[model samples]
Target: MSLSQSFIIGQYVHRNSIIHRLDPRAKLVIAFLFMLSVMLLNSWLSYVLSAVFVVCVVTISQIPPSYIVRGLKPVWLIVIVTSVFHIFLTQGGQLWLEAGVFSIYEEGVIKAGNIAIRIILLLVMASLLTLTTKLGDLAQAIEDLLKPAKRLGVPTQEFALMISWTIRFIPILLNETDNVMKAQRARGVRFNSGNIVRRLQSFIPIVVPILLLAFQKAESASLAVEARGYSPGMNRTQLRTLAFKKLDYQVLIISIFCFALLLALRK
Candidate 1:
């Protein structure tokens, strides 16, 4: 697929690779730890190492480089906007650029770079998890993780199902939007070529259809779930239970070690 149309956030690719074979709960925990490590790390080298780790994990997942790059397209824009905000607003350190009514300082640049790096690292890690794991597995993983909360009267299974369904619907909604955009374009509606206000106005047709379709899809899914005897607060059994294997243990141990190493590097 083209970079502009790279896979959606919740789209999954099933492959026989090691990363794909990993237990969803294990992947979920490692993902959390990885993001935590990136945020806690202070040194430049530590950030670089974290970035390298992400690259390595992505490579192991066997997802196409183009797909991963495309997934990052939206994130790059946010990074640029936020980085610019930090560069201009943040102050201190040596002056980098001096201009009337606008000045750039060394600290501002560093801060902007720091924010950009953190955003990219987190997005990459999150995208990797979604791309590699199935939504059903993710739901199960979340429910398993939240099992302890069941004692507190929490509806863990329902909560997990809701979270998974929300994520699972993201790509479906995007697809619906694309179909609406295409239909609108066929009727001579210009979304990209118009001025700011015009462009915003052009989406009026697209938005209505998406909203309707979202409700329609949700209604249909609920009906199907109910037909299958699914009910909130009801205990359920899995066809294939998630069990920690040797490989899973090894991966978790390695993940913990990496986080510990990152923590040490921060000091």
Candidate 2:
């Protein structure tokens, strides 16, 4: 599959579901806590529980299971390389294998699995958040959450805008890269075969063009921002003010309850 086909980060799914109806602020907070919980999780049982919980949440979000799974396609490369490093470089417990300079230990294997699962969980939750919420709402939600920091002279609006821009453009950049890849492939350039260095060298054709496109996009965004009289640390109006409703509070309470339940279960 093309990178754009399997990689759906920053894409919003317009669905009328329980999760979609909730305020983005609540969604943001819940996503943050969910990822944090994943990171803190240590045991296999905890991960199994978390994975089940994520599946339930995905169902509730009304996003197709295939979409959720496809989102992990681009992540496999990073996860594989990272897991390899963790398993080979890290050492503890019983030695699983000794191969010259690289030795795999039982603890390293366990740790690598743990970290890979953690990374996947984090990405899944993040993707779910972006999928269920619009970029505008996400940005406004972030600004609302960071409002208190404004008292300390923080440019909360700008910070939120920056994050919004980053998330909003990731998929675009990936699509652009995919287009470049297809173009190169049409010219008989191979990216998936041969030695590591060969594959890296094959990708060099797209780097400069992608960088140029990124710079052009940035310049255009800056020009548009200036045209709109954008200012940092200034009082701004929101299209839709984020206010927690009864349903939002109820979901929050349930999430907290489940978190407590998981904590107790882990203990």
Candidate 3:
């Protein structure tokens, strides 16, 4: 299987740390703010600061760096391609290498470095959120956070439930895909040996079974929810309540501080 096609799913690791104890909503909001700040940054210093911030947050979370990097393996190609294009195609400063129709400039090199750093920082920040927060907790947090949107005529609760279910099922789906691939392999199916078109054709058997199983699971889940008295437009009490603790406040303050610093540095 191609690197991009590999069954890599983000899994939450149980760690007793400040980051793990914070409200999932806080973590999600901080992650979004960090991503926005990183994207807004145009200088290399800002990118470096973002990278440091990511490392610090990951360290505080006590999640293994290996797991975060592993989750990012699928997107490494995209980062590389984007960096290469930025380095070679963008025009600025003195040329480092020049041919009849091609050149590499100093400014492009700096820009590419900044882009690469920002990409890595973004991935790390996202991975940190998934690593420390449970899918169920995240869903609840999202549901609570979106409560305000209900006044705007949006089905915030339903939307939150959808997001929660999707996040909750990602790992399950990945595991299911792995099992399906193994079953196909046992029947002499090779996913990697054929040409592009032939390989795609070979996927039909695998894809069909997965789709059927997904439908089966969906039906079962719907039935279970109905049996539990779940209904649209009805208020539901959650078993676990999300509350912002001292650590959450600390993290929020730090995140806001970092965001402001990043913005100021950008200017």
Clashes of each: 0, 0, 0
Alpha-carbon TM-score of each model against the true structure: 0.93, 0.94, 0.84
Worst 10 residues of 2 by lDDT: 258-267
Which 10 consecutive positions of candidate 3 have the poorest summed lDDT?
Answer: 1-10
The digit string of per-residue lDDT tens for model 3 on 7-126 reads 234567899998888889998899899899988898767777887888888788887777677777777878899989998899999989998888999999988887887777887776
Q: What's the candidate order when arranged by decreasing TM-score?
A: 2, 1, 3
| Per-residue C-alpha lDDT of model 1 across residues 160-215, encoded as one tens digit per residue | 99999998888887777788888898999998886889988998878778899999
Error of 3 at 46 (Å): 1.2
How well does candidate 1 match the true structure in TM-score terms?
Answer: 0.93
Candidate that scores best on TM-score:
2
The digit string of per-residue lDDT tens for model 2 on 51-123 reads: 8889999999999999989999888999999999999988899998998988999999998999999999999
Clashing pairs in 3: none
RMSD of each: 1.9, 1.6, 3.2
